[model samples]
Target: MNFAKPLPNYLVKRYHGWKATTYSENQVWYRRLATEGQRPRAMVISCCDSRVHVTSIFGADQGEFFIHRNIANLVPPYAPDGDHHGTSAAIEYAVTALKVAHLIVLGHSQCGGVQGCIDMCKGQAPQLEAKESFVGRWMDILKPKFDLVADVEDSTDQARQLERQAVVASLENLMTFPFVSSAVEAGSLSLHGLWTDIGEGGLQCYDPKEGKFSEV
Candidate 1:
């Protein structure tokens, strides 16, 4: 309970710098945003990786996108068993409340979470398979897709395939929500699956008809 601490000096300095420049230059816009609230056109569900800068990658300014970051960017099937569902909560808010038109699940290359899932599935990380591990439990959402890439012998290729599959899995899970499915059926909301290569800065989009991802 007493673990809270003041901001670090480096972060405080950076905050002051941004406040003096970006905030000062856009003071009116910032005030308007505070008064009017966010009205983003899209909802982005992405991995909680520091390198995955959703806003920066899309050249989005503040309040342009509703972004939710979770480990592996996995969305579980609609489970309304009264247990807390952070990703589902965000999806509900974005779909029903914000009425975002596009729901994007952004997966990326060299994801640590994906690697963890691979290791756990391969029996290389028994710690992650422990019942008490939060990550292990959360990663169970993607375990079903692991078998699709299990036959691939190349480590790099297998990882890449699974990474894209994560996005596909999340997109599939998104439709399980009644609100999302209804919105999609009504032509109000659309779902997209995207994968990015971190080192190469390349992007790919999933084509449901082709059942594959192609470069964007």
Candidate 2:
């Protein structure tokens, strides 16, 4: 398949147009962003889904947020594995290097990656590839949550539970990192879990009082 040939020509042309316009009108802001290294006050760990954009949702511009996105927006427990740990590395940079004060785990409703966990728990797992893929392996971290919530009353409720659980679980994982834990202990770092319902345009905070998600 000729991938390049399949793209709509107008869409590709617009990128060049945007690049030129940004260079012209936003020159001062662009120069400042270039000169002053990124010093984002908050960092967000979110899903790679096109619908859940951290910058757009937060109404942030360039150099505003240091974001790390993955399938289901996971953060695994810290370990010195001799492998490429993309999420872990990003977390390290955000905490140790960037020194961001707040870290947010942004989970969304109807997440496909969380659904993958639900499917795996129900014994209808997706087929595995020969080599370990990142999303597949990361979803395993939430396997226990899936197993615990698999028999919930409603399918939508089950999925929502899984999403919130994953968010909390990832926060726990963030604490597993020594740098993050140290900063948190010194009150230099704080963590939060948020669930955004795209359909209703509602933002919910993980409420400890109700031990569940609630509207903000």
Best by lDDT: 1
RMSD of each: 0.7, 2.7
lDDT of 1: 0.96
The local distance difference test score of each candidate is: 0.96, 0.86
Clashing residue pairs, backbone N/CA/C < 3 A, model 2: none
* Candidate 1 lDDT by residue in tens digits, 1-216: 899999999999999999999999999999999999999999999999999999988999999999999998999999999999999999999999999999999999999999999999999999999999999989999999999999999999999999999999999999999999999999999999999998999989999999999998
lDDT of 2 by residue, 40-118 (tens): 9999999998889788788998888999899898889998888889889899889999999999999998999998878
Clash statistics: count for each candidate: 0, 0
**Could you tell me which 10 consecutive residues in candidate 1 have the lowest summed lDDT?**
135-144
Error of 2 at 106 (Å): 0.4
TM-score for each of the candidates: 0.99, 0.90
